[model samples]
Target: MAWAAWLVLWALWALRGWSCLRCDPGSMQLLQELTGPYLSRQLRGDPGLRERLEALLQRSIEGLAELPIGLPSYMGVIDEKTMGEAAAHFRRAVTRIMENDYKDGQLFNEMMWSLQALRESFTSLMARFQREVFCPNKCGHMVHQFIDCRACRTEIYSCNRGLYCGERRLQVQEDDDLILDCALSWHRASYGAKSYRFYRARGNSEEVMVTSPDAFLLKKEVTANDSGRYRCEMLNTKGWVCSELRFQVTVTPLPGNSTPLPMPPLLGPLTLPPSSHPTPLGGPGDWTVWIIIGSSAGLVLLLIGGCAWLFRRQREVPKEDQDSPGGQLNT
Candidate 1:
């Protein structure tokens, strides 16, 4: 009888673990399908670009596979506001791509499509889960169960009370300092104090105050030496929170510049001096000369007109005297 009881207990524990393990293959498959086309497009231009993209995609896939299923499940359950925050992450990634290049154009369009698909998938999954689990009268909240502390974790929840609600998570980067950003906010009552506790991995890893709850801004400069896992604990006077958020931070040195140096002066095509052909109109002095010439031409035309007028008057007086026949002997 005693053995049977022990067996039943072990079986129950195993079942709990399996339920907490929220791995779904659909997300991984979708991610690959979306990114594969993008990388293939980039590969056509530069063989090196193709190789780099392949490596990056491989690493990303492997990392996602290693992630606890709970992470994606939590992502699936995120509300619209939290989902917006996730969208921003993708936007930032897309923004990192350089513009006006072939790779940039392809990557930008592909990323936008991928993000939209991701958002849609998450919304649909959450809706299905909500229909199955959520109840209006129940006060219980659902959160993503965490398995390890020295790694990344994500949580999603909705309040049954409907008075106060939020979703909080921690993400670790490959650099110094943990990033903790809130995605959703509710009533002032839900805006109480929260704190994140940090622990070292080695022996006597002293507990440190990484963040304190307040309205003040929390900004931590990232460095290469600050890689470690961290856990966040939120607290308020109401009661102890049930959800625990964990993440692993890895620090990587900044990459050095690898751009090729410009070619030597003699090796490149010789650039000729810009053309210095004379303009049709000389300069400011030329304008002055034109003005003087115009004035002289006008004066010459006026003198010619006066001489022609005098000649006409002389001819007219002779004709008048001949017609009158009064000055024949004088002529």
Candidate 2:
């Protein structure tokens, strides 16, 4: 019945523009020729009234189309009062338009049928909404943080403790999977034996979903594309029992070890290269490189020191021999 009614609304929507275009004073006969055969011989509405009602029907279709198909469990709850107002306006318009000769005009009867179809569509959608959406089960206000621990990025769901997902934002290293771990007791207690369906929403489009009878292992191998606001929902068979958590996932690069060293310029006659220039032995940067360069200088210093010590010793021995005559001169 819902499908049939939906089809009727679609047909009405498709024809609404044509009905308006043809209702112009010049194209009355053309409109009659087009729609007169389909509308039964039970409504003979006035021409002006018929035009007004057609316009009203167009407005009705517009309003219905604006409504979201399924009541989003997160935001934009269906407006029952607004829907009722539209239905009432439609009813009053129909009542005023089809006063006396309602059962003799093709156009008037067609309008009435379209109105009924619109009403049915509203009823069906509202019933489904009440059964499923008007009442949602659990959860909200979550921001989870995940750190890349070499192998994987993981975060544990706060087990019925607080509303915030975590203290920090989700940080995932490039090419690691994000794992969301949570205890399932809260949902189990709320939903009882009913099955669960998981839905994830990102940005402003329709949510992508998957179904599981129990707690689903949530692991997403993260990439640059995975950075976004993510909402995870757990819903059950009755649709009344639902739980959701909202969070943001951000991906970052791996840790770096060190920065690259700068290259030395080529040598010239007037200006020597960095290699040709004498470098200080001790410095803050490149200690190991400096030690390698100063090794030869250390050996030369050792040889000069030994020569000076021998010369000093010879001078001291000569002074001692001159002073004492025969102390000792061992070759």
Cα lDDT tens digits, model 1, 22-53, are 23233334435434665466546565655654
Off by over 4 Å in 1: 1-178, 182-206, 214-219, 257-331
Q: What TM-score would you give candidate 2 relative to the actual structure?
A: 0.26
Residues 1-331 of candidate 2: C-alpha lDDT, one tens digit per residue = 2332443455565433222122133333433432343222232334543344445444543443233334332122333333344345444544444453434334335555655654555456556544543432234222222221121233322213333333224778767887543334344434234444444545566465555664554566677776665544554445543445555678776678347897555664566446665656675457977787799789999999999999999889867777684775768
Backbone clashes in candidate 1 total 1
Question: Which residue pairs clash within candidate 2?
Answer: 42-103, 42-104, 43-102, 43-103, 43-104, 43-105, 44-104, 44-105, 146-170
Model 2 residue 297 lDDT? 89
* Model 2, CA-based lDDT: 0.46
Number of the top candidate by TM-score?
2
TM-score against native, each model? 0.23, 0.26
